[model samples]
Target: DASWISNGNVNGLGWSLKDQMGSEYFGLRACNRSLSALHAEMEGLLWATSCMRDMRITSVRFETDCSDLVDMTTNPMEWPTFATEIEMYQRLQEDFEDVSLSHILRSRNGRADALAKKARNRGYIFSHIDQTRSYGGVLRRIGSYIST
Candidate 1:
């Protein structure tokens, strides 16, 4: 549920700039770091969602694996956010509900400690998960379900 790691610089140059974190594909990078694989990060997102579902929770926290997801989800009406396939986009939008998303250090992904079980070769060294919010406002409606 929590993860953090010191990621390295851009182009192997120096440490990453925190403010630039949200702009990248992954979350924020740490200084003096290693390459973070994209597939692993994506897997992390998938696992988190699964774990939340297993908990019987409609609302759950998630760490971003890419700003792409964030930028897309936030723009509900934007054309690009729709994934070009109407049915796919509609399904994705529904799944996104109750997803309280945010970015975190890779070290904090407890379940991810198992190495994402991915081949090291197929990875994305994105320095940032670029965390953000998702699937908002589910709890406010809980009262309606409770019934007076």
Candidate 2:
């Protein structure tokens, strides 16, 4: 769960950045909402922070196409209505030693985006095909699995 939730834009992983939440981040108005959400980065950052705060760790190398959020999270610069956003992000990022920012293309964010959308529509009341877990145990260590 921890790994899947925070796994950034990686090959065959989830969509990076604001796209991370997948379709769950949208609704019937998905198309328009997605574009509107793109106007800023802090929105997702805040949500991610909410999801990650229990780990008791800080400092992260955050990346995304949403440069506005990257700037707001790391630069301490003022953004319109940014204070609230930072409050959450700072809480999450504070565990890190250094929070670097990286920008990547949107194509890399599809899997996670799909998962997010699925979660939103289904209320996350069922098993996940992604094998996502919350206790950082989702990713099975090599040689630890076998067919019974």
Candidate 2's clash total is 15
Cα lDDT tens digits for candidate 1, 1-148:
1122334122111111112223211122212222343322333444345433543545544555355444444564563424343334334335545656565555554333332222121233432222222234221211111101
Per-residue C-alpha lDDT of model 2 across residues 3-107, encoded as one tens digit per residue: 122222211112222223221221110111222343323444444443334333244444565565566656766665666656666665666666565665556
**Candidate 1, backbone clash total:** 18
Task: State how far residue 52 of model 1 sits from its true place (Å).
Answer: 2.4
Candidate 1 at 87: error in angstroms?
Answer: 6.8
- Candidate 1 at 124: error in angstroms? 19
Write down the RMSD of all candidates, one decimal each: 15.4, 11.3
Model 2: residues >4 Å from true position, as ranges? Answer: 1-43, 56-59, 74-76, 123-148
